[model samples]
Target chain A: MNRKEFIDQLKSSLSRLPQAEINEIIRDQEEYIQDAIQAGRSEENVIASLGDPKTIAASLNATTQIEKAVGATSLKQQAGHTFQAVFAMLALAPFNLIFVLGPFLGFAGLVFGGWVASSSIALSVVAVLIAFLFKFAFASAGIFSFLSMLLFLLGALGAATLALIAMYHISHFFLTSTIRYLRWNLKLAGITKN
Target chain B: MNSQFNKGVIEMCVLALVKQRDYYGYELVESISKRIEISEGTIYPILRRLTQEGYFETYLQESTEGPPRKYYRITTHGKKTAEDSVRDWKNFVTSVDSTIHSQEK
Candidate 1:
């Protein structure tokens, strides 16, 4: 293949990347080809020496996605980057879908489930506290009533605090795992930092 | 060499070369590929990653033959990394060599 066709193939394969990043990668390859040709090499020879465009694009996609995952600041952004990185990694080998997809889905479900459970527990505690306040306002002011109200308030606060701490811990675990998985994916794609 | 092994070595090679003098994309590719068989396309991503990691700085230099070229110069961080990597690689090779030779005997 000639230089243009080679670059066109590489560009099309890397369509998922941001336009600026895609352009930069393409420009590098184009310059390499230009230099090779200027140095008395044939277009075909230069393209051949560069190897397959699809493989090159796959490596580039893996590297870029891994970088994005590492650089993401927020949890939501990190999740997005991790998803993209995992998808890019799975793309490198179609058969990996069978082995990787099931475990990935399970892990995602567990994290989402933990979030839902923690949030619901916290919400329920608040709801109970609100309901108790309304009851205390309507009921007669007795010693037993006051004590019950104090007990309910303390219990609700304690439960809510515990739930929130659980949520924080769960989210932290998810973020750490996501980063580890991305690093594994990069290694699987042969983009190690060595 | 195995591609997996080459991937790591290539990063060190690039760092070591740039530590000696600044090199543009094409020039670096040519210099390394002359000694090691690698996909010339892979070097760009390595350069990009190294630059982002703050191990290298890049600038555009105008070329008389064509458009401006992006030249990469190693940072102090990159020089330190290269020295460490070279040391580790030598130690690894020595250990492996001794092990293999002993087994042959």
Candidate 2:
């Protein structure tokens, strides 16, 4: 559809959507589309490339499990959600941290520090038993020597990411349940669903 | 795919989708309708729930064809909720699978 037609159709299509949301989306998208066109693309091509705006808009409205980009809120809302997210994350904080970070660090720390602390004793025993053999093969340089540093960095990074992920999930859990929670809270607090 | 399941998941699915990208109402419903079965009218109520819960906030824009249209955007709480739900879902699925088909035996 042409741009005007497309916007009209998009509007028609959006009738089923939340009215305020459709308006914001269209206004924002229109700016983006215009920007894209000004950057030297044909309006027709951009529109065509964008596909039917209705279809695009439809997908835009489809609420998946997690939400998309979130905006900064007023102090009141910011505080409330921050409280929710922080509290929620805090609720699961211990287990989430342990699960994501515990094992990897324990294994690596043990292998490294344990090897260092015991190496002298281990080497002395080995020297008496198989000194020549020990020299022949780089025994201490097993799985970790060449790869530990690299793997440790990667593992630490992975663990950090997992921690973040865990925190997010925990927060989401709280938020989801809190929808109903808020319902009751609001009712008690004397606010309706308006 | 049925209305019952759709009803159950509508809030979740819509919230999740918007968590990934901003979407208008009809756009959300239509997009989700493709992957899951839900009546066209089903989304509005979920939108109402999310908005009332402050998981979503809305604004209206002028339209060329008729009256202004309202757009819903996810609140920070909404985004957090979606992400957490997604994580929980993955965890739940993983645990169930592991329990059902663990190799320790």
Candidate 3:
């Protein structure tokens, strides 16, 4: 393929990336091709030696997405970046299908479960309150009965809230550590650096 | 040799070359490709990554023949990384060489 064809293919492959990043990558490749042609190498020869544009795009996308995941500040942003990074990595190498997907899916399931459990615990406090109210409304609840129910409600809500907080931390830890693990996996796969 | 193994060494060569002197995209590719067979495209991604990691700084300089060229210069952090990597590579080669020779004997 000629320079334009190579760049066009690379651009399409990298469509998921931000436009600014896409433009920068294109610029670099364009310059390389231009320099090679000027130095007396034919466009076909230079492009051939450069290898597949899709492979080049995969490498660039993986590198960019991995960095984005590493520097992500919010949980939503982190998750999004992690997904893109992992997708790019898998596309970059066929072996990652076996090496990356299994552990990634397992850890993702754990994190998803943690979030679901935390939210359910937080929501269950409402159920406790409703149960206590039903007991008071239906029966002639005495003062001691009323006080005990109130205490029970408070204890349950406070414990649930504490558990929710702890789960938030645990899930957060898992997310960040999973990203670190992905980077280490890339290194172990010999795709990139430390 | 495995291309995966070359990937690490290519990164080191990029670091080592840029540490020695500033090089533009084509220059660096030609320099390394002269001694090692690699898909020339792989070097650009490595350069992009190292630049993002703050190990290399790039600038554009006008060329007499065509459009301005982007040049890469190594940072102090990059120099230290190059030093460590070269040292580690040497140690690894020494151990591997000895193991091979011993097996042969």
Candidate 4:
């Protein structure tokens, strides 16, 4: 196929990426191909270098997670996911603080949040303890006394907070990078065309 | 770092090309290669992905050059995205111009 036809096909395929991921993938390909051609490469040679599409697609997925971890989210998709996660965490923060910081000794609202938070933390700990001590059955902890919800919450708060922070950062980075990448890419493509 | 990274922008380029005029796969690839250095197979995934994402829709047309060739057309959403991204690019370039490129006040 001629180069235009090939790109048309490629463009069609690229549209399938998540709205947030569109630019990150497209600009990279356009630049790579442009550079290769400028260096006097043949069509057959260029195609060969790109390798299998399916394999490339799979590799792209792994990179996306990393992109997310590093504040790589794009501006356009700012409200997409990381924001959602942050909000969700914010909503849960009250619960998390209750168990970890307040530990059931507080106002009714704080105590209520603590109770729920402690229950969740207890469940996680119970699962881990069961997996090790019991016959390696993780879910069996379900049958155990949800009795020590207070202790479980206090114990697990540190781990949960850390996990939440990690999650928050990844989402924030990924969404921002995607937005920025698309913004710049679209502009570059536009300039060359005009 | 890789062609995969360019897939999103490439898709926009494809849509832009078609906005001016429709082209087949081989022709599209040729036109793009003239401007950029990329793997030939690279465009295929971008095409497939764009189609999946609904930016550009496709239909098969009989071709005199070879077998029925697939034709890709940019959808409304695709055009909007391309335009928006282009606008975003201008802001970035202007910033870079003042902050990094420009020396004289």
Candidate 5:
């Protein structure tokens, strides 16, 4: 391929990247081709030796996707970035599916379980409070005093709120650290530009 | 050999080379490719990343023969990183060498 063909293929492959990043990547290849020609190499020779444009674009995509995953603001956005990054990583190397996905799923399950437990803890208190009110309204009072029931509800609600807050922090920590861990793994896997 | 191993060493080599003197994209690629076989395209991503990480700074300088070229200069952070990478690489090589020799003996 000539310089234009090479750049065009790279640009198309990198369509997911922002225009500015795409431009920057194309410029590098342009300069490399220019320099090679200036140094007396034929365009075909330089392009051939540079390897596949799609492969180069894949490497660039994997690196930037991980950076985006790290810099993402919201949890939802973080999840999106993380998936894209991992997908890009997997595309670069199929062997990574076993090494990367297994640990990733295991940790993701733990985080999901923590969130589920916290929400259930918060919701179960509300359910109990509703049940107590229904029984009190229709039937004779039970062993516990009304004041004591109110106090118990307050205590349970408070504990559930605390659990929710703690899980928020724990899951947040898990996500950030997991992204960092993936970035390190990418470096070791040679998917990222170390 | 292992491509991953080459990449790790290439990062160290780029840091070390830029620490010694400023180099443009083509020049650095030429220097490294002289010693190690690699797809020439690979170096640009590594260069872009190292610059993004604040380890290298780039500037455009006009060339007499053609258009302006982008040159890379090592930063203070890059110098420190090069030193650490070199030290770590040396220690790793020494340990691996000793292991190999012991196994043979």
Candidate 6:
């Protein structure tokens, strides 16, 4: 391919990137081509040495997406960036639909299930304590009822506390592993520039 | 060399070269390709990433025969990273070399 054809192919492939970024990359390639020609190299040789535009575009897209993921300041932004990165990976191969998407969905489901289980446990504890208080308020005051109420409250509080602690750990593990997994996936897909 | 392994080493190589002196796109690619077989296009992405990571800075310089050229200079952070990477690479290579030599005995 000639320099113009090579640059055009690269530009089309990188259409997903922001305009500014796309321009910067194209300018860099243009400069490289100009310099190579100035150095007494043929345009054909320069293009040949540069290799395929599609592969170059793929690497560029991956770098841009990964940077977005890493630099995202908020959780919502991070999720968006991760989604973009995953889509970019999926674009590289169709089998990634099964290989990457299936495992990611499974992981998301596991995290969601763990969260729901912990939250329900905590919610049930609250419900039981509230019901016990209502019963105590209506019934005649008795040492036995008061003792039982005290025991029930203590048990409920302990269970709630344990559930909350478990939730914290589960969320922490989920957040860290999600980020690690995204980075690993990008690297495996040859999306990472280094 | 494996592309996976080359990706990391190439980052360091670019940083090391810039640590010596500023280089533009073609010069840098030519310098690196002299030693390592790589798709010349891949270096641009690496360069862009390193610059984004704050390891390198770019400025345009007027060329005698052309309009101008963008040059890349290593930042202080880039220098420190290069030093650390070089040290780690040395340690890793030495250990691997000794292990291989011993196994051959």
Ranking by DockQ: 3, 1, 5, 6, 4, 2
Candidate 6 residue spans exceeding 4 A from truth: A91-98, A109-176, A181-194, B2-5
Q: What is the Å distance of residue B1 in model 4 from its true position?
A: 12
Candidate 4 is graded, for docking, as: incorrect
Q: Distance from true position, residue A149, model 5, in Å?
A: 2.1
The CA lDDT at B36 in model 1 is 78
Q: Model 2 segments beyond 4 Å from truth?
A: A1-194, B2-4, B99-105
**Top model by TM-score, which number?**
3
**lDDT of model 1, residue A149:** 77
Give the top-scoring candidate (lDDT).
3
Question: lDDT (CA) for every model shown?
Answer: 0.77, 0.52, 0.82, 0.52, 0.81, 0.78
The DockQ of predicted model 1 stands at: 0.41
**Clashing pairs in model 6, backbone N/Cα/C closer than 3 A:** none
Q: B1-105, model 5: which lDDT tens digit per residue?
A: 446568578888889999999999889989988877787877777787688778999998888888778899999999999999999999999999999999998
Clashing pairs for model 1 are A194-B8
Tens digit of per-residue lDDT, candidate 3, span A24-76: 88888888999999889998999888888887787788778778888888777
TM-score of structure candidate 1: 0.85
- Each model's TM-score, in the order given? 0.85, 0.34, 0.90, 0.40, 0.83, 0.73
Query: Could you tell me how far off, in angstroms, the CA of residue A165 lies in candidate 6 after the best superposition?
Result: 12
What is the C-alpha local distance difference test score of candidate 2?
0.52
Q: What DockQ do you compute for every candidate structure?
A: 0.41, 0.03, 0.45, 0.15, 0.39, 0.37
> Residue-wise lDDT of candidate 2 within A1-194, one digit each (tens)?
57788678777755645688677556655754554455576777655644555434333333211122123233234324433432222222334334524553354454445435444444444444354345436655555554654455455556555554554454444444533343332222211010
Tell me candidate 1's TM-score on chain B: 0.93
Tell me chain A's TM-score in each of the predictions: 0.78, 0.33, 0.86, 0.31, 0.76, 0.59
lDDT (tens digit, per residue) of candidate 1 on A1-194 = 88789989999999999999898888777777888889999988888877778867776776677777677777777777777777766665456445876887788888788778877877877787887778878987887878887797778778778877776677667766766765554444443221
- Model 5: per-residue lDDT, tens digit, A1-194? 77789888999989998999998777767777889999999989889878778867776887887777777787777777777777776766668556868878798898889889889988999999988889888877755697699789989999999988887777678778767876666555542321
lDDT for model 3 comes to 0.82
Q: Which of the two, 5 or 6, has more DockQ?
A: 5
**Residues B1-105, model 3: lDDT tens digits:** 456678578888899999999999999999988877777888898899899888999999998988888999999999999999999999999999999999998
**DockQ-best of 2 and 5:** 5
lDDT (C-alpha) at residue A12 in model 3:
100
